[model samples]
Target chain A: MYRLSGGAILWQHHPGLPAATFLAMPAEPAPAARPVAAARRRRLRADRARQLADLLRHQILAGGVPGGVLPLEDVIAADYRASRNTVRQALDLLRGERIVERQPGVGTVVVCEKYPHGLDRLQGLAETLREHGRVTNEVRTVGPVSAPGPVAHRLGLPEHADVLCVERLRRLDGLPLSLDLSYLPMDIGGELLGCDLENTDVFRLLEQLTGGPLGHAEITLEAVNADAHSAAVLQAPRGAAVLMLERLTRLPDGRPVDLEFIRFRGDRITMSGVLHRSL
Target chain B: MYRLSGGAILWQHHPGLPAATFLAMPAEPAPAARPVAAARRRRLRADRARQLADLLRHQILAGGVPGGVLPLEDVIAADYRASRNTVRQALDLLRGERIVERQPGVGTVVVCEKYPHGLDRLQGLAETLREHGRVTNEVRTVGPVSAPGPVAHRLGLPEHADVLCVERLRRLDGLPLSLDLSYLPMDIGGELLGCDLENTDVFRLLEQLTGGPLGHAEITLEAVNADAHSAAVLQAPRGAAVLMLERLTRLPDGRPVDLEFIRFRGDRITMSGVLHRSL
Candidate 1:
């Protein structure tokens, strides 16, 4: 099974195998294949198409279909007990969402793909996705400045206390992924002024500077419209929604130290985690 | 501290106190308060304003300012050691993002508000947000039917196995919040047919019927443009982004049983959690 970072676990079809080899037998008893009256049938067909699209979406997300390739049209109609017209409409709806597309000879295929980002781990972007591709950081700004009110408070510093601010535009395989604004206490940040900010993860730098493993992070995730500056920096369309992640990382001794605001392109990243019930 | 579910912890100001009373003394040694020569100074001043805006944004998210109220313009200038003009420009930047607004006699106050939704719990909407307000489920569709491909796989059922599907439009207070689609294997969902789905959480019913607490859930979250159907049902703007949460829940014995696709009005809800690092 192939699990898309977006929480879709699609059935992965083996290369060289015909797509039809993986088709599952129809579960529901077949509905009458005959078409009904034109006017009423059109209305019912629209509704059925929607329902079929919804089902196909779940199937696609589940990875029940092979290797992102959808089964043949006749196969889907028979499996869902829907007429060919209804199946076509369903496929059309998926097309409108840009989730799937028709290829000249490849038939219907899933088009939307996202990289998985683990929320449960407190690793830097590069560390988490090291296997996927090379992650490069383009350092935009790095210098000492007084902590803003909120930044100071989270880092447990006095208001206006001097802190090191680092701004970076991170890319994955040459594609813009996120714009990260990070603040660190000057005392710790000062020692790393000469270190490689472009190639190394800050999490790794902090551990070396502090001489211990970081403890935990308090995270809040939300969707927000990208401002003009952020959109321009990330190359995302102006006003497009971006996933905003605000995190405060603390040392094992429980002192809050590093705070970061990372804005990720919503289309390219998916945050996934296994969460346990606390209460 | 007021923690916006989206992970902002703002300093709450007491009622009746003047906003300026909470201002902190300047942190940096006043950046040579003397204004520099024109052309260079104008460019410098613009940069300063952007910097100031960034700081204030952090402070607001961290809850440093009082009660979502900005300090008086002059007071802000004094605190950040900036000229009044730069402070005003910074405010204008925030206003552009619609995060804060000017109220004639009230000064600038935060305009964005979101309820907190915890990511580290296996509770229904009502259970998770019981303290905030009422959460009512508008049952849109419910019945037994053949499980879709993905639903069946997630539920450990055979292809097209009979299952129950429950669709609900959940609201907080009277505002539309989320549209939820839930799938359960027939044995468990069948028992919930006559239960009070509107007022009671499915988690509660599942616990009662299964005779145990749920184990955990695997969740994936991302932002997606709301389709026409979802946009209309949630009363959200057409094509506006929504937070999409997909979850697969299991029993204590690790049996996958319930699968859900929940789309939240991104503007109204925030998902927050504390994550531990586990390599």
Candidate 2:
């Protein structure tokens, strides 16, 4: 049987098995107790690593680490007053949860928790991202085009009906994230032709044009291979798997207002939320 | 300009452009109406394709097609009373929506929508799938083991505590869909040691064992690359992206009971639900 004693708790265990005895130690161990002391040191290191991981998780969730990049390992170790091995262990914990990824030469980077959109809320991407922090839009195209057959049907318009197409590359903290393509009926979208779309959200613009609150949306999420257009715009490799959100937003009275196709890089975004059972 | 005439409508427009004019026609035209007749036939074919697609979509959503595979194109054509080409077009529509994928030599298959679990419901996968139809479970393992450090912490048990580990491969319509690993405190899970797991849902068994309602769960969703163990069991390629749901379930009085890690094949499943904006 092996006996381990630190400052407070004394534990006795069979070698290579779990501890079966517990007792209190009154004083520090003698220097002859080298193996048990080493074990205690390892356990203390593990505790320290867990503590550091908890701190970093909170900081990351609170947006303290902007741009989703963590500091160098040595820097983190120095800051936490822990050994390099302890810091490595802590980062490994985050990596398992996908909260961070270690680049070969770039150090550990905090990569989890992309702007979360509540699947239950009828909100636009821009509005959702804005609530998190600063977001910018690069409007690629805004013009009238003949609606595609399927799009026309979804928008309750006749085949080949006029529609306004607005394509934007959305950026969060200056990092390219999602590509948003929205189609709007001509009668409602025509008014926004002269307006600056780069500074305005299409959902908000549609709300203003229709003079009513945008109601619920029928949203479908799918894993799709990025086509040429989406791959180039989202900067993902050709045919890479991406999360596609197809949304048809309607007015409060059930009049369809916009048909949007949004593509997000799967590696860079995670959509998550809590579900409460309704009584 | 090209002039096209159909029953009750006449239009003149560029041959390959959207129609610019529409007018009513009184009677059947002479042999000169052949071109317009062909165009009308094409339009009708397109309409028929869309209608077929809608019907198939509804049928698939209602779980009418078991094993997540659609019928052969000719079979679907015969069933819908549409031409083979029209049936192909309908399948193409489903492909664009990521609802079905065409296997190399196996024909088009309904690939997506594997028992959608609403983020709003506090339901287990087996429970949700059972509500729709039959579900079977293959219990891979059930035994007492030392809890891994992270799992022990998540379940609020001491490090190296004895816990019951259960691994199950869940099947829907006889096709393996998900691999689930659950760690439960021995004091709570010990009662289930002798129970038949294949025919019983774990959540239901837990409720019975604990004699209390399983309370809210802290759930997290992430896209993760499948590891070798998971890839082999789930029959997905190594490094294939999959949806991972990590849940820590609690009892009504806030006692953590189970820590679960569930992996779902991304292409075969989609988690989607409506969100309402709270005023």
**Predicted candidate 1 versus true structure: per-residue lDDT over A1-279, tens digit per residue:** 332332222233233544233322211112453444465444435545656776786566555577999999998887775678778988987776566899989999998656778987888999888887998887755656666566777799987776676667899998899988788887787665667777889999898888888998998887766656677778877666678788889988888878888888877787988866554
**Candidate 2: stretches off by over 4 Å:** A1-113, A144-153, A156-161, A225-229, A238-241, B1-115, B131-133, B141-164, B210-213, B252-255
**At residue B29, what lDDT does model 2 achieve?**
32
Model 1 misplaced regions, further than 4 Å: A1-98, A101-109, B1-98, B101-107
Residues B1-279, candidate 1: write the lDDT tens digits.
332332222233233543243323221123564544565455445545655776786567555677889889998887776779889988887786566899999999987567789887777899888998999887755656665555677799986776666777799997899988787887788788768878888988999898878898999887766656667778987656678888888888889878888888877787888876655
Q: Candidate 1: global Cα-lDDT?
A: 0.72
* Model 1, position A258: C-alpha lDDT score: 84
- Measured over all alpha carbons after superposition, the RMSD of each candidate to the real structure, in angstroms, is 10.2, 11.9
Where does model 2 sit among the CAPRI classes? incorrect
Among residues 3 or more apart in sequence or in different chains, the pairs in candidate 2 whose N, CA or C atoms overlap within 3 Å are A120-B275, A120-B276
lDDT by residue (B1-279, candidate 2, tens digit) is: 222121222222223644222111111233364566676555445544544565576567657787888888887765554568878887876776567898888777777665665556767777767665666767654555555455577788886576666667777777767777677887887676656567677888888887766877776565555544466667766555567666678887778887776777765666666555343
True contacts kept of 1: 0.39
Per-residue error at A161 for model 1, in Å?
1.0
Deviation from native of the Cα of residue A251 in model 1, angstroms: 0.6
* Tens-digit per-residue lDDT, A127-171, candidate 2: 767776666677654555555455677799986676666667777
